[model samples]
Target chain A: MYRVKVYVTLKPSLLDAQGKVVKGAAVNLGYDEVENVRIGKFIELSINENTKDVNTAVEELCSKLLANTVIENYKYEIEKE
Target chain B: MYRVKVYVTLKPSLLDAQGKVVKGAAVNLGYDEVENVRIGKFIELSINENTKDVNTAVEELCSKLLANTVIENYKYEIEKE
Candidate 1:
């Protein structure tokens, strides 16, 4: 099996309200060092061994269903098991 | 600067509603090959250089602020920038 680890984050130009909320909470929780606490999405995919050309498969998946390319940016790592 | 990439995921015992929703959408979008789409949180922390022992710092931050240990499991990567 191949493990696909995907990290999806909003574009820098976009505002991250969720991250800001967490940052405020962190400050209340006494973690002053915390800054720019951006929250995004992480997805894990266990690609079937039969899938051909795993690289192409992941790229297609990311663009089509996994990520909304207009507002979010994504990059991934492929691991062999 | 230290780039700390943190991944927070729900434990196997927890229900992942967001993942289920995405999987259902994928099925409707004609991507039946997709299975077990687990969604989690991806956070990037730009650590200041003054922070000593980056490993310990990330561990503490992950437990205290980045993840909820009760239901989620977290891991991280630390890189120099």
Candidate 2:
């Protein structure tokens, strides 16, 4: 069996309103040391396949359907057990 | 200073092509136990300010910029040292 970990995040140019809101809340709660908030995503997957040709197959999947190349970025690690 | 962590993921219904590719690769690589791959994002931010009054402000910010309620999901944690 194999496990894959993926991460996606917004481009630095885009504004992060949610991070700001949480910052505001922290300050209000007397946790005024907080400054900025940027949010992103994390995903983990388990694949059932032979380890021989998984790399190329995985890359194809990433380009075709896994991530939206325009707005988000993605990276992944593969582990075999 | 405070740190915020955010995670975003696809709403299950959407296709995860990246995951499929990874699975295929694993199978070919002779690691046939791999099954699926789901991709997501992770974000970390630090705020430098008085710890008071940050909560409300943070929530407002989240609603305005951080996450897209229509598509993504988010959560956060605060740490003080």
Candidate 3:
């Protein structure tokens, strides 16, 4: 079995209202030293088959549907245990 | 130093149109075995200060802003290296 993890984040040039809210909360909670809180997405997928093409398949998955190239960027990693 | 990773995901009962799109791509790519591709978010933050209050601070951050309690759920793990 394999576990695939994907992270999705808004483009750096875009305004992340959600991250702004978190930054505010961090400051209020005394994490005044923390900066740049950008909120994004994470996905974990479990695959039963062990195929050599999994990585490419997943990369295609990200480019095609899991991420929006115009506004968001995605990075993924796969692990086997 | 401390690294905090946060994961956010839509509630299972909620509709995941993004996941649906990924599922379609998987099918097209011959991943006929792939199923139920729900997407979420992951955040990594670095803290230079080693304080006992960090976890509480992070929890407060999550409750206050890092996650939307209404439609999303969040889980975070902290690591020091």
Top TM-score hit:
1
Q: What order do candidates take by DockQ, descending?
A: 1, 3, 2
In Å, residue B48's CA in model 1 sits off its true spot by 2.2
TM-score winner between 2 and 3, please give it: 3
- Candidate 2 C-alpha error for residue A3, in Å: 0.7
Where model 1 places Cα greater than 4 Å from the true spot, the runs are none
- Please give, for residues B1-81, the per-residue lDDT of candidate 1 as tens digits: 788789899998998999888778766876566666789999987767777677887798789878889999998998887
Candidate 1's displacement at residue B58, Å, is 2.7
Task: Point out the worst 10-residue segment of candidate 2 chain B by lDDT.
Answer: B57-66
Model 1 pairs whose backbones collide? none
Docking class of 3: acceptable
- Model 3 Cα displacement at A62 (Å)? 1.7
Highest DockQ model number = 1
- Show pairs that collide, candidate 3: A41-B40, A41-B41, A42-B40, A42-B41
Off by over 4 Å in 3: A11-17, A28-33, A48-52, A69-73, B10-18, B28-31, B46-52, B68-73, B79-81
Report RMSD (Å) for each prediction in the order shown: 2.1, 7.2, 3.7
Q: Chain A of candidate 3: what's the TM-score?
A: 0.83
